[model samples]
Target: MTLLFLHLSRSDYKNFLNFMTELSYQCNITLHQSDIFSFLKEETYDLAIIDAFNPCSFLVIEKLGIPFIAFCPGLFINAGRVGIPGPLSYVPEYKSSLTDRMDFFGRLKNTLAFMVSSVIVMKMDALFDQVIDEHFPAGSRPTIADLHLKPELWIYNVDFSIEFSRPLLPNVQWIGGLLTKPAKPVTPELEDFIAESGESGFIVVTLGSMISSLPVEEFLKEMNDGFAKMPQKVIWRYDRSDWPEELNVAHNVQLVDWLSQNDLLGRVFVKHAFGVGTGVPNLSLNHKAFTIEQAKHWCYQTWKKVAPQLSYMSGVRDWVDQRK
Candidate 1:
């Protein structure tokens, strides 16, 4: 059987490649770096693993006629108002924003419209012919549909021991942090810096791959000030040319062009923290305010919501260690 990995970013590609290599199952593997749509026309895949963030994957699945898996960082369920629960869900509505964005009156109108549309699409005579028993099993059967509707599946990635509060579907697996192995070794300068910082621990700041080069000098300055007050060492992952001079002299700070984030965060001393523009809170109140922003654009408002906190470092560390 041929297993095709689709729609992965560069970092994700690295992780997926490593995981596939380690797996005992023998299958033909092909990697496509471009968008799933472009790749779909050229080839066919037996099984597809897709990032849920890319909604277009759903369309691809319909074309490919394969049982595929969807992966997401977090599933936003409607809690109260605009608030979403911490856990992820596989609800189709959640995947689409049709209902989530409708106003109160508009929601009511849309609900009626949806019911009418459903009746037309699913004919009354067809209901009786449908085999419900085949889809919904007696007792308990591990099914994606069941897990998608219910958040209790408690599934998580294997490489990282990041557990879910609820149960998860048997088929919905996690192999997130497992792909890449450790790098050679930390340089002497970096090693010495970590050693000199005593027991207060260190802080590691990275904004993932896409926006690592964006100019955020003012925001970085604020972060530098925040770190300056804390009694911890700071390791800022920044491009050397973009490094701000004001932050260079601090004895407590170590600036590098790039560091192995997964490895560094695994270390005992490194704490993870991210900075956002002052306008973060306001943006949360209005989700549609920045629709035109590019995927790589770093809006302080959006970053604040998705950004990891320093306290989450322990949880992330524990997750990684468990994978080992």
Candidate 2:
């Protein structure tokens, strides 16, 4: 029997340390005193599923001696942990901002970052050592690497289409879109608005869940000016309650307090006149937006070129069948 629980203190967000530091701080918590572990000892779970990013979970589950599977919700799992090639050559390091395609300097920077992050992850994983020492006998206590390197499976909740081509072990499963639901027409107002847009299908603009508002007032003005010039109707998810009253609202753009982002995205079937633009928000509170035409032309089209060759949900069924 297995249970997966990840609790992050709301207080952690108050200071908002660097992403790695925050994860490390979370790992600093000891599970030896938790009542949940006492209950875990009594119950019988067939398998444990745990957050791959959290080493403490691995240790707790390992203490139960039940086979466990892990999931890395984000991209950076160094497959090298299992003796597979997670070479710094192609696989990006944490927060490197460099894609798989790299030049000499890019590779050098990535290598440095990879080394640094590996140390950080190692330290984070080690934070649970006291718990392990307390629970397991000194002679039998497993090292951090032993606990980390032996999960039965690693489910990467990642879009394969977006990832750089790289080797994966048999135990590593690439499954995606698990959280995506069928687009719902629950919002009557949005439904009516989309219906009125007709053949010129609407574009959905959102900075996503964490970002409720842009930092600067000028950013709003620029976005307003830019959206006004667009041909297609835009439903931009912004915090309308916090919107500046002095700004002129674009007629083409609909500002809402919040949007059903997945519903909006899944429902829309529109020919995009503009290519994709990504503002790499590196876990920072402030986000800067920019529009560069050359980058838009280069970045989005290359994915289309490579996507056809890739397989979606490959090896997952076989992996499951073998495990069963």
On a 0 to 100 scale, what is the lDDT of residue 70 in model 2? 84
Over 53-170, each residue of candidate 2 has an lDDT whose tens digit, in order, gives 5566776787778998987754434455545566778765544555768789999987777666565556555555666677678788887677767889888765566566778788
> CA lDDT of 242 in candidate 2?
80
Tell me the whole-model lDDT of each prediction, alpha carbons only.
Answer: 0.39, 0.56
Q: Which consecutive 10 residues in model 1 have the weakest lDDT in total?
A: 280-289
lDDT of 2 at 43: 88
lDDT of 1 by residue, 1-324 (tens): 001112224675455445433331221111122365457746766666664332233333533456666554332221111122322232112212232234656555444443443342233213212222232246533222222333322322332222223334454545544445665677788888877778866666555454444365654554455556656677867676776666553567777887876456543232211212222111111111111121112222244223222222234433323322
Using all chains and alpha carbons, the TM-scores for the candidates as numbered come to 0.43, 0.59
Error of 1 at 210 (Å): 3.9
